[model samples]
Target: MKKILVVDDEFDILTTWRLILEMEGYEVTTASNGRVALESARANPPDLVITDWMMPHMDGVAFIRELAANDSLAQVPVILMSAAAHAPTLEHGNAQFRRKPLSIDDLLDLVKHKLGEA
Candidate 1:
């Protein structure tokens, strides 16, 4: 199964995503803050990461920057989720952008596309 790390401060969003991904056959791990997300990634890197823009302690941009800077975790693909159109510029690699209020089909399509599946 593909592993996905979902980082978001909002419980409802996190829970909602976890359920959605789980139903899609993706192994989902969630973090409520960027700090925990970084730690979890370091401990057990996920194949894909979906993160919220605004977060406590560290933001999504900062988290990805740090992860990209690290050799061990730099290869992981990331998807940035936000209500705004602003997608952060990444140094290591590009990340997929998904806007807020995305439909289930849209989310699944993006996730599958990023995972290199049709």
Candidate 2:
């Protein structure tokens, strides 16, 4: 089973994404803040990561940089979602990005595509 780690500050967003991704038969884990996200990722790296840009401790960019830097976690694909449309330009390599308020279908499509199952 493919694992997905979702990092978002909003509780509702985390729950909603968990439900949606779970229903699609993907194993899902969530972190409410960037600090927790880093710990979780280091503990059990996911096959894919979907992270929000603005978080209290680590922020998405730093998290991605860390992930990319680590040899064990660097192969995992990332899908960055943010309200800011400028986020995609900030990072490069093996990532899919989307704006917020995307439908479940679009989210799943991106996930599937990133995982090379689409």
Candidate 3:
């Protein structure tokens, strides 16, 4: 099974994602913010990460950079989601962008694509 770390400050969003991903057979781990997510990832690197852009205590961009800094985690792909009017720059080649209100089917497909299981 593929492991996915989901980072979001909102508990409801986190829970929803966990349930959805779990039902699809992905081993889901969730963090409330980038800081916690980074720590967790370092301890046990996941296959992929799904994160919200505007989290507190280290945002998505900063988290991606941190992961990139580590040789072991740099290559891990990420899907960054945001509700902002203007999209944030996604410079990480291994990272992808998704706007808020993304459909569940789209999210699942993206996850599969990222994991090379599509």
Total clashing pairs for each candidate? 0, 0, 0
Q: lDDT of each structure?
A: 0.87, 0.83, 0.90
Which of candidates 1 and 2 reaches a greater lDDT? 1
- Candidate 3 has what TM-score? 0.94
Which candidate wins on lDDT?
A: 3
lDDT of 1: 0.87
Tens-digit lDDT string for candidate 2 (25-86): 88899997677887899999899999888887888877887887778888889888888857
Q: Which ten residues in a row are the worst by lDDT in model 2? A: 85-94
Residue clash pairs of candidate 1: none
Better of 1 and 3 by lDDT: 3
Error of 2 at 51 (Å): 0.7
Between the candidate structures 2 and 3, which one is better when assessed by TM-score? 3
Better of 1 and 3 by TM-score: 3
Cα lDDT for residue 112, candidate 3: 86
* TM-score of each prediction: 0.91, 0.90, 0.94
- Per-residue accuracy of model 3 over 1-118 as CA lDDT, tens digit each: 8899999999999999999999888899999999999999999899999999998899998998888888899899999999988877765769877899888899998998888551
Stretches of candidate 3 off by over 4 Å are 116-118
Query: Model 1: per-residue lDDT, tens digit, 59-117?
Result: 88889888899898998888888898666676648576678978878888888988854
